[model samples]
Target: MSVYYFAGASIVAALCIMIVFKIHVDKLKHSPEQMGAILTKFFIGVAFCEVVPILLLVAGFATMQTGLEFNNLLLPLVCIFFSMIIAAVFIFLQTKVDVTQEMRGKVYTFAMIGLSLAISIPFFSLVGLLIQMQ
Candidate 1:
């Protein structure tokens, strides 16, 4: 229960943090080219962002700190994989949309929301790992 509780709470916290960051990005009013550029750079950024969380996961595993059965780790691991896939798809598609093809307000907004949520899911495994380590 502690593991699940930590995972769920961390997921919620991460999403909230992402939402805050998205709000700031939304205020920038970037042009379509700018948005596409950001999306391209963002792929690189996500990869870097994942490094620390992954190292934390490795540390936890090495220390045998996870309180759950081995199978229990599978769900969160799969979640992290799927979320990265989703983020990649969104970034790829968004970058492909030219200015003529782009929708102004809601489409970009929705995409950012989705991307942030996808990014946030990895925190589930992260929190689950960190809580056990402590």
Candidate 2:
């Protein structure tokens, strides 16, 4: 029921993303041609950072049960632990993306991986939440 965990997750994610953006902006400052690609990646990174928190918040708000389901905290705790770790993973992927031929494939691969994770992790969290409430 604590909002602090969700808020902290968002803050940590935003801070990590801001660092990535700063790095990308400085690196591309000399070549404005590369800015478009970086901006695209930046937006993707932003989405990466936001997905789990929103999903978990929705789950928590919608899925709480009427009884003492306290023993099931472990499931959500694990889900939340891994959810927080995704921020660092996003930073890694964002920093790796570049506007180069060799790096193009890598970017797409990382993006797909990120997208897959963004989908799966929240889904698992929802399942965990539901299990806990039952």
lDDT of 1 at 22: 48
CA deviation > 4 Å runs, candidate 1: 1-28, 65-134
Tens-digit per-residue lDDT, 53-107, candidate 2: 5665565556445443656455445545565466446645564545566455544
Q: How many angstroms is residue 27 displaced in model 2 relative to the true structure, after the best TM-score fit?
A: 2.6
TM-score of 1: 0.40
* lDDT tens per residue, model 1, 31-116: 44365555555455445555554555454445545456657665655545555664547443653454233445544564665466
Q: Highest TM-score: give the candidate number.
A: 1
Runs of candidate 2 with Cα error greater than 4 angstroms are 63-134
What range of 10 consecutive residues in model 1 has the weakest lDDT sum?
20-29
97: Cα error in model 1, Å: 21
Candidate 2: global Cα-lDDT?
0.51
| Clash totals in order | 0, 0
- TM-scores across all candidates? 0.40, 0.39
